[model samples]
Target chain A: MPNPTAAILIIGDEILTGRTREGNAHYLAGELVKVGIDLRQIRVISDDHATIVAAVRELSASHDQLFTSGGIGPTHDDITADAVAEAFDARLDVRDDARAILAAHYAARGVDFTPARLRMARIPEGATLIDNPVSGAPGFSIGNCHVMAGVPNIFQAMVTGLLPRLTGGQPLMSRDWMVMVPEASIADQLRALAETHPEVSFGSYPFVQEGHYGTNLVARSTDAAALEAGFAALQTAFPEGK
Target chain B: MPNPTAAILIIGDEILTGRTREGNAHYLAGELVKVGIDLRQIRVISDDHATIVAAVRELSASHDQLFTSGGIGPTHDDITADAVAEAFDARLDVRDDARAILAAHYAARGVDFTPARLRMARIPEGATLIDNPVSGAPGFSIGNCHVMAGVPNIFQAMVTGLLPRLTGGQPLMSRDWMVMVPEASIADQLRALAETHPEVSFGSYPFVQEGHYGTNLVARSTDAAALEAGFAALQTAFPEGK
Candidate 1:
């Protein structure tokens, strides 16, 4: 069976404007890969309603799971919840459950539940909440779309809580071999080796350090035997101390 | 007139698998912002031919300019040039000019131009070469789509050579202000302030540090006067040390 596929939609003006470098997508990609989910695509888009809604709908329909990070805050610019609701054609309002969670958390700290803060309680109808351990503001999951915070800490916490609940396939295994040779010198042989093992995927990453050119060849596969065989082939092709 | 719009397509399996963190998008985003180009979206996809071709065609048609990084190396996994050609319905073959460039560069280093290395000379028909100062392999531009190397140093060099030739708008100016208050407490005021300045764009980034909550508000505009005016309004709304 094919591994479950996922797509990530990162929404924020700070990322688009280059004011903030995104860390959530990279974090999620690693986690998803470990869980045997194929992360097919990741898109970073501006904080706009139409764009967010379109991306959410398209990604959710195509991929087995969709994760979105950013724009779910109490600021005036936060519009992710509303856009998601519009995408699913669901009603959006401040639910008592979400409000209660926020209210109690804020009350414990002796903070007022200001109207602006209440905006965080607004969720789409028929959605379940994703707990935020770092902050009180909860994320939500409507159908296949799981919405999470933009902040690295909070996003990590939410993902930790969410991943185990989803079904996963056999985890992919990867092995790497580094050789002090330029990629072009070995391209034909590498291509022939890859063709010999159809089940495994091969990738060659070139680097230049200290006036020396080298390539890091990585072999990946869900089957451990295939991965090992591919790695052995790669090692034999470019033995160390050559 | 609005700023010229562009989209980026990052092609690599390592990126999707989280084996490598991409740096080219962030670098390109910052450069595009400074030159007044609106980077509308960035999509990271794997090295699969069909996927790369679809993304290349879609992004190239929609945006005024399309920048693709990765999959243009000499390895078996590198297939970006062929995918790009398929996207534009153009033929792919090794041209004499590209081969000459590679041959000269390799000869200077006293390296043999193997058949595998010659693969780097393949260029889509009717494409102009984008120089790679860091490496001998050249990137190309077919239509508005500029295909470049995935390596950070080579990509940066190509972008430096490319951006100066493209049309640019007025450089964007921005100012940032930080306040030691939760975003919820200032959302309404911020909304009002943003409404007052139609020419400027406001963004609120929240943070929690040292048991204190705060927000960093950023104002951006192509017009320097409008940006300054927006900054003043933000300062008046959230006075410092208050």
Candidate 2:
């Protein structure tokens, strides 16, 4: 069976404005790779309502699964839940369970659960909560999209809690050869190797280090035997790279 | 006048597979903000022809400018130029000028100008070349799209060389206050400030550092005077943030 495809929608104006560097997408990308989920695309867009709704609808409809980060907060700019609800044509309001979580956490700290604080408890209809261990508030999974907080540590924590529930395929196996030569010098060998190994996907990355040009040739496949054969062929073709 | 809006499309399988971490999007996002161009969106997709073509058409039509990186190389997987050409309805082949540049560079190094090496010389019709100083091959600008290399240094160089040719707008001015309080405590003030100053965009980012949670209140505006006024209001509203 083919690996399940996934897409990530990053909703934030701060990232688009260059105020904060994006970390969640990269983090998710690495995590998904471990579980053999194919991350086909990643989109970083602003927190506009129409944009968020459109992005959620498009990504969710196209991919097997979707993940989103940012815009779920206690501030005025936090509008992801409303936008996502509108996309799926679901009603959104503060749920009793979510509100209860916030109330208990805040009551222990002696902080009043203001309207702004209650905003975090608002969730869409027909969604299962993804637990946030660091904070009491929970993220959620509605349809194929999982919406989580923008805070890095919290986002990472949420993903850790969410990945185990997902269906994963076989982890890909790969081999690499680092050759200290201009890519042009080895283009013929790389092309031949790529053509010979139809099961493996090949990549050639060139870099300049210490005034010498080099190419890192990588081959990846799900089949271990094919990857081993490809590696042996690589060693025969470029012994210097070994 | 409003700033020119732009989008970046990154084409690569390595990034999607988590073999490579993306840096070009973040670098270009910061650079675009410096030149007063509003970066509206960023999309990272794999080396699929249909995907690249669709993304190019969509992003090019929606924004004032579009920038692409990766898939311009001397390997079989290097299909971005052809996909972009197809998207714009232009002919793609090895152009004489691009070929000459590669030929001369190779002649200086005394390396064979093999078919694979010649692959780098392909250019779309009606496109102007963007110089790659690090390597001899040139990237191209066809219509609103600027296609460049994916390598970090080369991508940075191409952007630096290309930025001066485009029109620029007023640089954005921004101010921020770091308050040792949960975002919930300042949500009301943030909402009021957002409503009062429609010209400025306000954002509240929460972080937990050293076991204490805090909020970073940021305000941005193109008008320096408006930003200064917003900073004053922020100081008055959250004196503890000082």
List where candidate 2 sits over 4 angstroms from the true fold.
Answer: A109-111, B108-112
Model number with the top TM-score: 1
Evaluated at residue B186, the lDDT of candidate 2 is 92
Per-residue accuracy of model 1 over B1-242 as CA lDDT, tens digit each? 88999999999989999899888999999999999999999999998999999999989999999999999888888899999999999999999999999999999999999888788899999999999888888999999999999989999999999998899887778899999988888899989988999989899888889978888889999999999998988889888822
Tens-place lDDT per residue, model 1, A1-242, is 89999999999978877888888999999899889999999999998999999999999999999999999998778999999999999999999999999999998889999999899999999999999877799999999999998988889999999998888897888888888888887798889999999989988999998989998888999999999888888788888712
In candidate 1 chain B, what residue range of length 10 has the lowest lDDT sum?
Answer: B233-242
Worst 10 residues of 2 chain A by lDDT: A182-191
Expressed between 0 and 1, the share of native interface contacts present in candidate 2 is 0.70
Clash-forming residue pairs, model 1: none
lDDT, candidates in the order shown: 0.91, 0.91
